[model samples]
Target: MLLKDKIIVVIGGEGLLGKAIVNGILHEGGVPISADIKPIKDSNNDIDYIMVDITSKKSINDCIEIVYKKYGKIDALVNTAYPRNKNYGRNFLEVEFEDFCENLNIHLGGYFLTSQQFIKFFLKQGFGNIINFSSIYGVIAPSFEIYAETTMTMPVEYAAIKSAIIHLTRYMAKFLKGKNIRVNCISPGGIMDKQPINFIKNYNSLCLNKGMLDKDDIIGTVIFLLGDISKYINGQNIIVDDGYSL
Candidate 1:
């Protein structure tokens, strides 16, 4: 029970990766509270749920207040939420400038606001952990050849946002030096989500395992980062992509 009684707030807790992290926390004896714009159904009653709009400061503050009121302390916060505009996955050429900016505001801006707020609280408490999500695409440019037969190409905005997350984590970690708050990032490879067969094959060929990762593949790292075992780790981006970025 590495986490014991630690209380963790998981942003975007209703989604696939979020749900896996939440379960991992539970298994490690941590208390997890799920916060997202969408309501979570069919989850264990022990899991707390809160509707949150990460882009809204008011909404973010309110969610934190509710959690603090109920749990008295938040030991860690895992931001997996990626609120984006409707044109999120559009082709690069087709993506409108306005939509691109909007997506950045909603996704990166939300991350900034949420982290700023939590850092304030962490400062007061003298200890906190923040785990931000990044992607393999952030480290390496996409392989356009992989999508030859598919209508998919990595979105330009996605690359921008994910790369930004890495720098943001480092910046916050350094700024919080001696403050007892740790900030880190996890850059994961493409999780197996029933993507196009051709894309999957190409992606796997680039990886050491020659396979797309499963949702559970990311759980152990989450547990390690959030727990006391990684006390000396800070300001680092741990890539969990099975050498896919190579």
Candidate 2:
């Protein structure tokens, strides 16, 4: 019941991580609103869904308007949306320069616009919380050795965007000081989806305990950051990598 009666807006609510965060908020007795470019199918009725294009300032502003119109106030915002172009996942040498810039425009630019709009609303309301997502890659370079045999290699754009997010969180936290708003980031290690066995095995070997993370492993951090318990916490990047970086 950490977030009981609170209203939280989750961008990219249809993605795997976003869905887990939505469920986590509900479990904590908070109202979770899902905002994305597409609608979620077979979603719970308790969750509110809003369509938004983070790349557009109007769309971002409209999203905030919709949330305020319905809930009167937004207690927190969790930005997990990463809209990538078709050229994503390309290997280092295979990656095209235009594709890299496009990915940044859609992903990092989107986060910036959405956050800018919400911070204005938060300013008016006198308080707000923002939780941004980063990756363990942001903290340390990807171990190229891990993906040796697999078709997967860390995309250059991903590393750039995630690293930027961490600094952006710190910048926002400082800019919003004395305005009763807090901004923090979560840098999660690799989440265990159905990756190739070789990749999984290689990744797990570097971890302190379990190799890859389950989606549920990150929910508790989300809840804690969004709740009153973290009132004193701001401008921090909390890494949840299970010691993989070590």
Off by over 4 Å in 2: none
Q: Please give, for residues 78-193, the per-residue lDDT of candidate 2 as tens digits.
A: 99997989989998898899999999999998988888989999999999999999998888999999999999999999999999999999999999979999999999999988
lDDT of 2 at 124: 93
Error of 2 at 31 (Å): 0.5
- Model 1, runs deviating above 4 Å: none
Predicted structure 1, TM vs. truth: 0.98
| Candidate 1 overall lDDT versus native | 0.92
Q: How far off is residue 15 in model 2, in Å?
A: 0.5
Against the true structure, what is every candidate's RMSD? 0.9, 0.8
TM-score of 2: 0.98
Worst 10 residues of 2 by lDDT: 37-46
lDDT of 1 by residue, 1-246 (tens): 999999999999999899999999999999999999998788689899999999988998899899999989999999999787877899898999999999889998899899999999989988999999989887889988888888888999999999999999999999999999999999999998879999998888888964789999999999999999999999999999889887
